[model samples]
Target: MSSLNTNTNIKSEIDIRKKANYKTEGSDNIRTKKQKKYVLIDGHVYDFLKRSFDIIFAIMFLMIASPVMLVVAFLIKLEDGGPIVHARICIGKNNREYKMYKFRSMIPNADQMFQLFTPEQMERYKVGAKFDDDPRLTRVGKFIRRISIDELPQLFSVVRNDMSVIGPRPVIEREAAAYGENRNKLLSVKPGITGWWQVNGRSDCAYLSDEAKNLQLYYVDHRSMGLDIKILLKTFKVVFYGKGAR
Candidate 1:
């Protein structure tokens, strides 16, 4: 009986040692992976060229779009005598926070009036991050939103270096939680005015939904100057066709 007990003790010690070794190896593997590095592009040249492109095109677009922006601004103020733009605080590259520029498509007190929505409307807004029949929209707001003219002002962000001309869409800070382990990867490059997710399906895929995160992260992983150009061209089509603006 003593021999059996000794054997059982020995077996227990062996099992414990095996588990300890396994845990050590597991931790080592994770540490090794964490130490390895990845990069978005091959060289500094790509980054420089991308930034140059953003700057040049941002200037051009702003010059050309300024008149339209002014007209829209006038219409917004004429409607309700409210603010003309909405500078939403959003997450940018390296987890930097910046105010993303957009033409105002809601009433000036829109953020303060959430409780005015019906529970059903609030739920719908939460699901899509925008309400199709949002009460905050002024008459001018509906037109601009439907045609996506509201986002034209984001050229200012590109010019200001807060965003890229083409990359992943900037996300609200709270939405960062949904990226999970990929948050660092997503924030490695400047967010864009247009991107893979926008060209594929804008608000059709609700913000932070699995589908939206997958599309955004896919762009982050496989981004290139060539891909950016493709997205820019495709974005024109999506915008002109009013494919998924709502």
Candidate 2:
């Protein structure tokens, strides 16, 4: 948070410098050079709508998928003989840590063997990245993950007010910590099970990078009810088409 404040101040300084430079050039440049403040234009109405949508949509899905979730839960136990659901902490709004739930998709000891993989593999696993041929995934896990049937359990989290239906994907706290200066803005909103990254091009958390600050910044700066609906509509396409699978 301290770093974010410092970075914000630095940007403010840079904007001031750019305005001064524009003055020496021409009057036409002045209008274009005005500093854009980060203000969420929609305010309380947007927040209310975002929450209402999360709750209404989550409840609706849970009702429709109750049978499928039950079947998937049973299949998980029969496949690997472990807990049917998996839960772990992810950084959310204001970078607060909260437990997120998903149907168990890997071996019970999946975390124990994670260190054996190279740096390339570490990101994917930590950020809930599951490969199509990932051996750690049980047979049932593959099917659920492919259709994102595995993520249905998170409706409970949305019900509990710990997550959003649309926003940036939740990341591990360490992953947030690794962001250094950019973490605060990213953490300002609740993490979602699906968001622009998934809809735009990303599939998993293991691929996070510090240089993605622009994308992260865009999310906070431009998030709106209309944009949220657009993202949600796009997410449906990703889920049905298995957009991120490899």
- The top-ranked prediction according to TM-score is 1
Clashing pairs in 1: none
Badly placed stretches (over 4 Å) of model 2 are 1-41, 115-130, 204-206, 210-214
Q: Each prediction's Cα lDDT score?
A: 0.86, 0.78
Residues 1-246, model 1: lDDT tens digits? 999999999999999999999999999998777555223334466788999999999999889988989999999989888889988899999998999878898888788998889998887677656657888888898899888889888988898999998998888877886788999999999999889999996978787688888899999888878898899899999989988886
**Error of model 1, residue 116, in angstroms:** 2.9
Best by lDDT: 1
* Model 1 weakest lDDT span, ten residues long: 34-43
Residue 52, candidate 2: alpha-carbon lDDT: 94
C-alpha RMSD values across all candidates: 10.5, 14.1
Q: Which residue pairs collide, candidate 2? A: 94-187, 123-206, 124-206
Stretches of candidate 1 exceeding 4 Å from the true structure = 1-41
